[model samples]
Target chain A: MSNQELDVLRSKVDEMNGQLLQLINERAELVQEIGRIKEKQGVNRYDPVRERSMLNNLLEKNDGPFERSTVEHIFKEIFKAGLELQEDDHRKALLV
Target chain B: MSNQELDVLRSKVDEMNGQLLQLINERAELVQEIGRIKEKQGVNRYDPVRERSMLNNLLEKNDGPFERSTVEHIFKEIFKAGLELQEDDHRKALLV
Candidate 1:
């Protein structure tokens, strides 16, 4: 491949990576908000029922080239990460 | 600091990071096992009650330079990550 073509491809990859990082960070922020809400309500941060419902809903809605299970698996991690971010913030607050 | 001192410090940090990575991977494997069990039992991946109990237990046992809340938060993320690993495996199985 030409140097210019390679550079363009690298830039595209970088752009996608940047977007993914932004989304992950955004999700983390949302999780923090959820944690605060749970703390205020005296609710647990880990909600199995809610998680199951989400998975089921996603399964129902999925029309995927990817498997239903694959989608669920990916989303579950995303959800869990978000939950962790919230939990971390709550813990830090409690520590102070 | 001497060059030797810096090298030793860097090595120590690398060793610690490696240990942490191993533990995290080990935890992920355990989570995959738990996921299989849950799938067999028709149980949900996220168990808020179990998670809360764990946090409370950690809090009770903590006599930390770190706060109880900090421990809880860190462990909560660890637990959540493990759960996600399992869920991912289960979902992949379902898709296949």
Candidate 2:
């Protein structure tokens, strides 16, 4: 009984993982597009104000089993990686 | 021309961020459900084999503006965070 329940939950987790992978990649592409636009406009890619506004928007919308701080931390990591993507040099992946 | 283009792309990025936030939280909820089931069954919550398989599945599906390595790295961080959420003693939010 419980075994079947566990299997169902595990499969759902797998489905969620697939969805997350797709969404995060899609977000990355959008970030890259923005980076290209910024480059054309001679603007800095890392706009802390814009980043802060975006983070606030996310935090506002986050209704989570995960805590607010955890969500913020993960998004900041995602945001940092996106910024790193924008740079021409130093595109090393975070291996931790 | 470029300024207007930038606005459009930035808004799209914001939209993506919102969607990603929802999906990630949803995933976390599913993880918590699985954790509860595992606890009831007296199984170790952190299954490295399962984790490796899940990571490989995501990597296989990764069609990315981010490199495959980068995608893997980000997902690993996410997986680690998920694992942390499952623990009773160490739910300290990753403030990174």
Candidate 3:
């Protein structure tokens, strides 16, 4: 590819990466909110059955080049991170 | 901090980061192996109850400057990432 074309492609990739980061951060924020709700309700932050159900639901909905197992793995990590944020918030409160 | 001290600190931080990365990757590999086993056994990849139990166990074990909740959160994210790697491996196999 020409230098200019390469530059444009790089920029596009960077932009896409930025968008993904933003989406991931937003999702994290949502998870934190859920954590707060759970804490207030005296509910546990981790729910494996709900997580499995989510994965299965997503797998059923998936029709892609990406395999269902791969999708499940990615989503599971994302969900795990969300739970972490919630735990972090709770910990901070305890420290105060 | 003195310049030499700062340099030493920075190096230590970098070394710690590297160690963490290595550990994370190692954990990911283990998860991938588990995924393969699960696949053979027709088991689900995501297990929320187990995750919750883990978090609680960790919390009970924690006696540190880091809060139990924070510990839980970090571990949850790590576990989640491991699951993702496993799924990714499974997906690749399916595509072949």
Give a tens-digit lDDT track for model 3, residues B1-96. Answer: 234543453344334333333334444554565566667767787878866765665566555434455455556655666666767778988998
For candidate 1, chain B by itself scores a TM value of 0.77
TM-scores for every candidate against the unseen true structure:
0.45, 0.87, 0.48
List the DockQ of the predictions in order: 0.02, 0.68, 0.03
Arranged by TM-score with the best first, the candidates are: 2, 3, 1
**lDDT scores of the candidates, listed in order:** 0.55, 0.80, 0.56
Report the Cα lDDT for residue A67, model 1.
52
What lDDT score is found at residue B59 in candidate 3? Answer: 62
Candidate 1 vs 2: which has more lDDT: 2
Instruction: Give the native contact fraction of candidate 1.
Output: 0.00
Over B19-80, each residue of candidate 1 has an lDDT whose tens digit, in order, gives 33333444355456556666776778787886676566556655543355545555655565
Between 2 and 3, whose DockQ is larger? 2
Predicted structure with the largest lDDT when compared to the true one: 2
Please identify model 3 stretches exceeding 4 Å from their true place. Answer: A1-96
Single out the weakest 10-residue window by summed lDDT for candidate 3 chain A: A13-22
lDDT of 2 at B65: 72
